[model samples]
Target: MAVKKIGIIMNGVTGRMGTNQHLVRSIVAIRQQGGVVLSNGDLIMPDPILVGRNEDKLQALAEKHGIERWSTNLEQCLADPHNVIYFDSQTTVRRAEAIRKAIKAGKHIYCEKPTATSLEESLELAQLAYEAGVKTGVVQDKLFLPGLLKLKRLIDSGFFGKILSVRMEFGYWVFEGDWQAGQRPSWNYRKEDGGGIIVDMFAHWRYVLDNLFGNVKSVSCLGVTHIPKRLDEQGHPYACTADDAAYATFELEGDIVVQANSSWAVRVNREDLLTIQVDGTEGSAVAGLRDCKVQHRVNTPKPVWNPDIENPFNFSEQWQTVPDNQNFDNGFKVQWELFLKHVVTDEPFIWNLLEGAKGTQLAELAIQSWDERRWIAVPELSLGVKQSDAVEASK
Candidate 1:
């Protein structure tokens, strides 16, 4: 069996998410596992060239990972004939321009979500990729998480009959860079730099809701800057121009009500940083990052409500943990392997740029709902009409 090496130009590797998840956990992990095996017994290995602005960081990352290639010249990397795919994990503001340049170079695209700051640019990139006839994909890593995977298995097994509603709680307290250093980049709190909880997180919510439950029909949302001022990387206080918290209610196709709260200021008191509770007529399930617990109708407890009397029911003990019968890999690495196979062996990859545009569409509608303080309908996204066209067409 032969091993084929597919050169990948991975940009924005110096950043936290880029460095930890995409590079180390995913790409490097895939390499260590002997790459992805193909249908024909051949293996397709991802040969990623780390591309970033910082030479020192790039060199250090490459050396630490035992990678041979690292470059600061994105243009030169794109120009190389050997590189078949261009992956970007840059800050949201810079992603569009860089992806456009890569598309112009006729390379396939794989990148992170909320593809662009606006719905117009997101759709534009989708349209451009369609015209260019190049394969494209966006990271939808949450779908591959072990907890969510177990949840999917339960759904498929008819454990949740007539599923009702989903409640999601996601977030943790990020330091303000005053006493302890901020865990997230300071740009995340600045609206000018394409930063906001709604824009950042709604992408994940859109895909998670659409893929597992149903397509979002409408949204009612409230966004707020809970902490108006936070210290920057330099420990200097700056006005937070973006929403630090978002409380959103989404209506899905089956009339499922999804209430999601995403915040960076909230303290952790739940089972995990991200937990999704799915309720149904027959059963219910609560899923965290790596574990899932479920309660069936037969095993569910009934408790009497008496405010004056002390409660005796152990609510948390009623559910049983889902077994990890099979080994689950890192979600990011799993997705990378799938994308690599899709590129080399023509495997089907459903999470394309258009699907990503749908995410951007949801985020935009949520923001609109927040601004208008009313429910906003999610219009079906198609190539028949563009956001830019509607502006001039109205006049």
Candidate 2:
């Protein structure tokens, strides 16, 4: 059996997402499973080279993971013929330059989302990758989540008849960086660092909505920076230039309205950091990060309308917890395996860079919409600088 030696260059291993999701859960998990086995008995073993600016950090990570290679020089790593895949989990502002370099180097790309800070740069990267003929993908990790998968199954099985609307509540109180230690990086609080809840979470929302409910045709959003100032990593106060929260509503193609509220300053009172409630004509389902619950109209609570006194609706009583199934499992690991399979067999993976670009486009347009206080029409992807050339080339 032929073993495909795929060299993966993983940038931003120093970050939380890079360390936990990409490295520990995905790459390390893949290696532990004795590599991914193809149907024809071939093996896809990822020879991942950790790439970052910090030598000490890289060395520590490499040693911790038993990984042989570590490099501070991204260009040098890209120059190597062995490193066929360039994966970036860097700062949103830095992603464009890094990915563009990787694409020009003829390496396939698999990177974290919101591909670029600006939609234009995202489009350019996608166009370049398309023209260069290299495989590209974005990490749409939520779709593979156990709870979300269960919800998808319920929907697929016709548990929810005709989908009506989706309400997503996502957030947790991110500590003020000044008074206390914050959960996320300090850069996430600064606009110049490409830090904003809208950009970060809306990209995830786009795919989730598109996959679960319907295609988003339009959106109206309101973003706010609740905490105007926060402490940096070194305990110095810094002005929070980016929005900490975003309340967005999407108009889908089927007239399905999806509303999402994302924030870093909200106190958690829900099932999880992320919870999605899908109400349909016949039934409804609520999905959290790890669990889901379903309620049919037959099972829905019968309530009398009384507005005089405290007549609060006890809707929780109506829903029944979704039973755990066999495949109710880890999401990050699941996507990682799928990616490895796609890499090995050239499988039909829809979550490509173009799809990623679409997410970026939506987020960018949403921000513009908020700032301009008007609806911004999402432009179709023109692969090149000119529309006519892109159309002809696409054809």
Candidate 3:
């Protein structure tokens, strides 16, 4: 019967993903739904203040969303006791500094990945948050995707009995700014700006492999920059220093082998921008962003090798589509709601800062593997700062 309003400082929301996914599709949509309903008939409404560098952009975004608060000064917003949560969608290079400030201000944290460009800094943030005793959550939105949800269902039902391997294909060709404007920001191709497909996509892959199939045991990755030069936002050509593509193979705890090819410089010729095909002993399934199709061992078609003539079997038509069993909300919004509940009543939220750090760790190792052209072992992470260490941090 009671409505509780919580304040959130949404930083770097003027960016593309920040504006569309986190702001419009998530926060704005949540407000439109009359806020997140908590158990015991209570409602939790988010009062978000959009914070960015540009005043005009922030003001325009706020006005468009029917929000009254927008701030150019993040410190000023962080100092306010009303704003209890800090959400960052800033560039990889800028995220840690802002998060450190927010943690110092004693605000709960939620943000997009990779949390830091390096594993050391990521671990430090996780440890700091633990010492501060602040509730934290990271964006593991892919796990909540409808297609992945169906894939999870299949895994749980023994449909893929004794799962073996997974093949993930993810990419879309980003236009160079010569004839057409690039789809992504220019910073995405600059190594100095914390940009690379390995760093970016390995973050997502780590949790997906860990949570769904098993914890990653080892990784062998190869990364490259396909496009040497690309036009920046202002049509100025700049040399690309970061890896635009990554081909990675992972060994999971249950002996599951996962192969992922992530790229920004390749053309798509698939059902979705991202698709994962899971093959197991009993059955196999292919899942995209919204759809999953499966073929059981009994139903799978076998064809004799005849490359001389056209194949007789309708390979694509063999699989059956997975039905949408229930209404699915936006993945980002769903995670946001869970974090809100966690902040409110200590709900069991698992995707904390350490999980985010794990993503960064995977990315770091992937890059290292690519550089060395060798398989790297992934050690289990159990991070906590001692009371004395926390005291030292204070001094």
What tens digits encode model 1's per-residue C-alpha lDDT throughout 1-395? 99999999999988998999999998998889898888778988889999999999999999999899999999999999999999999998999999999899999999998899888888888888888988899999999999999999999999999989999999999988888999999999999999999999999999999999998989999999999899998889999999999999999999999999999999999999999999999999999999999999999888888999888987998889999999998898888888888888779999998889888888888888889899988866766576687322222
Score candidate 2 by lDDT. 0.85
Worst 10 residues of 1 by lDDT: 386-395
Please identify model 1 stretches exceeding 4 Å from their true place: 384-395
Clashing pairs in 1: none
Candidates in descending lDDT order: 3, 1, 2
* Per-residue error (Å), model 1, residue 97: 0.6
lDDT of each: 0.91, 0.85, 0.92
Distance from true position, residue 333, model 3, in Å?
Answer: 0.4
Predicted structure 3: lDDT:
0.92
TM-score of 3: 0.97
lDDT of 1 at 57: 95
Task: Return whichever of 1 and 2 wins on TM-score.
Answer: 1
lDDT of 2 at 246: 94
lDDT for each residue of candidate 2 in 1-395, tens digit (9 for 90 to 100): 98887899999988999999889888888887888888899888889999998999999999999899999999999999999899999988889999989999999899999999866677778889999999888999999877888899988898878888899999999999656799988888888889898899889998998888777888889999999988878988899999999988888877788889999999999879899999988899999987899888887877888789896787777678887767544577677667778776888788888889778878877897789887655545655576344323222
List of clashing residue pairs for candidate 2: 178-231
